[model samples]
Target: MSDESAENLIAVGVHVIVKKHNFSKVYKVSENGTLMLGKNQKVEMHEVVGKPFWSTFEMIPKRGPSKNTYSLRLVERTESLNDLSGLKGQLSGQDNRLIVDYGTSQGLSKDEILRLQEAGKSGKEIIGSLIENSTSFAAKTEYSQEKYIRKKERKYMRFLTVCRPTIVSLHEMYFRQYHEKIGGLRMDALAQILCYSDVQADGLHLLYDSGCQGLPAAAMLNRIGENTSGHLINLHPGNVPQTAIVQAMNFPQELRDRHVAVNIYSFLRLHYQGESSMLDNISTSSKKVTDHIVERSVEKLNGETKSDEVSRTDTDISELETDAGENSTLFLRDAEKDADTLKRKLHEFEEAEEAVPVKKPKWFLETQRALDLLNSSKVRGLTVIAKEHPLNIVNALLPFLGASRPFVIFHTYREPLQETFMELKQKRNAINMRLFTNFLRSYQVLPDRTHPDILMSDTGGYILTGYLVQE
Candidate 1:
């Protein structure tokens, strides 16, 4: 073929009609590979040629035993010679429907045209498909000049191998589907869960897991804070292996003393089996809890009494003295009386505090710290895995949390955990908490179902999923 004739042929889109040697067999190529057409069914290709060829037909069986005895024949050619400059000029005055028709005539689907309009499908993809299949469908007319299609096909195939899935599409598809099933939780809930559960108050305890959902969760929590008045905290415990301590030190000053004391003790009891002795020592000696309580009580007493004169009376001096005189038998009787009197005063203070229904200060501190961390752009949401007493973790977290909040927790086949969750629904305090469970092996959430705000998995291990809430 003449150079100009070859070039013209290459520029046109090809239509290939392949007929089988035996009427019993039929074939066609698609994105998924080759499919055997039904008997008497013929295979036809439309709008196939451009610079790169194989885009017109996907290669089949990346690696497998070769089948050499295949009958292949290409029997028709078609060319697309639309004037782009003229089309562009006419686009403004012409109806969109008419332009779409023109695109369809050029072998592009409506969806493909829309994609093109959106700049999704690259120009190369459109051009490549046209070139590769044009030769096979070229007719005996002047526009049907023959040329080597294999060279172009090989080059296009190489391009396909290097192409990566578009990130925009991947994220859109993944999150769209994820939200659809999960009832579209806001980032605030996620941030709150992460900040409170994952990040400790001291900011030294960091949760490490392969699937990081903190960023999204933190984003959600921030939104929540704007809508309501609340605090959030995020703690990151650095280096798990070296800190056999798991550092309850990260808890807020108040929580470190009371609420977390109990929980941390439990967590340590489970985490360190043979080393309970070490945990015991830390738990008993770390006056952090007492200090927190003392500070909180002092604050409350200060708030109740307007004058600073009574501040000294609110001090736990008697308790301190009792503690200091523990070794002296002679002072024991005096210490006991002082201790009893101090205990009564403390009980009265606690009762008055309870009358106001203030939340456990420690819980609030822990939750606040967690929320703060989640809000930080640098940290993502956390994954909480509770191997023992998953319900306790849930109870501990749920009481301090707010409504329409985002948090994910998991539990195994433990019937008690499920029962506990069911029981939580009865309490007015638990009205805001939503729970979901996945018994299936797949981690994927479907697009149609109403996904739980919190998803629990029965994989025999309790895990909290989703982003951390930031405040």
Candidate 2:
């Protein structure tokens, strides 16, 4: 059920669409589910559960049918096609020994048609009877006959199909259904991300997304592989995480645990300052407490924990000190305060690491744990897709990554990306800078009668991709 390409099989908690004749509606599959169509037509979950998606079934007739008591006829959509031809060709004139004056053919009477339709006959049988009853039946062209059959089949068809939701299927669904909520990201753009990023199973991906309710993350998760789990680091703004895309993806339980969400605020605290900055601050400060923090950091990383105290801390004091140095006044008391007050503040800072999280999420972790991850990371790539300009963010994040780490940024417009490209081009830390926009059009594939769709999406935003090469 977790596989992105795994379709046909119906499962609970997945999105499905019930299609009957010309009417269709999408639904989340669940047990004992019932859907009322038009005024009287209804669907039951038991009729669809364990059935292959896209397979059509018919409503079984019963006396004074109650909603719950109705049964289904597994009318295999292709059951009559057991004798299908092995070859294909255009419907030529006179091939079926039939020609018709489409303008002059008088259709059967309504009463007569109703009597035939209510005789409990199959769609095929009903169509056959109507064709035979037509006054011009023997004079219609083969193509005309096929055209007539299709038109009537749609009106009289009583079968419904359960459509499977694949990436393409889901994309169409989202693009058409909730275009604005999912950041208005076109399907082609989504496909482009999966290819350009080159993210795969077992690879570590760091992503900052503030668009379309976490849809980019979910897309990457799906591309990484349905059966093989992938590690994803989701970076988002504010305290509450936006993983709407993850919800839409509907990953299985085992795979859902693989996603780790870290707020941008927490990520910046540790990533903004390096060890060298901390050491410089330590040399300048007269506080011996900074040295103690450095020692504990080494000890903690080396697995030399002597008690539960150090282990419980959210982050080491030295970790905080790195962020504190830039805005030292924020953490430090006024100059008028005595030395003891400053030392007491240091202890309180140290104790904060161990304090239970109040508003932070514990599923992946709080800010302190994110700070720890900041120092211990070997992630290979970064992907940014946000409503805000990502230029300011890319510059700050480049130095934290190892050499030759690729990063891609997506935006609907090119101006922000152009600015970032210029900055990276001058710094020399990023190479292979290129601006990209996909020109995509789909063709309708049919023998001797195919052409590009009458209309297509003209644009799918811009992409900037490059690698960080430390000087």
Candidate lDDT (C-alpha), each: 0.34, 0.66
Go through the candidates in order and give the C-alpha RMSD of each one to the true structure: 27.5, 17.0
Please identify model 1 stretches exceeding 4 Å from their true place.
1-212, 221-231, 235-389, 398-417, 425-471
Task: Indicate which candidate wins on TM-score.
Answer: 2
Worst 10 residues of 1 by lDDT: 240-249
Error of 2 at 68 (Å): 13
After superposition, candidate 2 runs with Cα above 4 Å error: 1-26, 36-41, 52-55, 60-71, 79-121, 125-152, 175-188, 213-215, 226-229, 237-250, 262-372, 396-400
lDDT tens readout by residue for model 1, 57-81? 3222222244311222222331112
Q: Across residues 1-471, which tens digit of lDDT does each residue of candidate 2 receive?
A: 556435547777786767665455667777888766667756665767777778678865444536323356677553232221111123334554454345646576788776665566666666766765666645556456556666776766566777854566566656665666666678877776767666889667778887576678878888776567467778888777877556655677777766778787656754566444444443345235665775565555335323433453456787665754544453233322434555577778657733733333353244445456545766677888877888888776665566787888888788999988998888778888789898778899867659998766577788898888877
Which stretch of 10 consecutive residues in model 2 shows the poorest summed lDDT? Answer: 81-90
User: All candidates' TM-scores?
Assistant: 0.25, 0.61
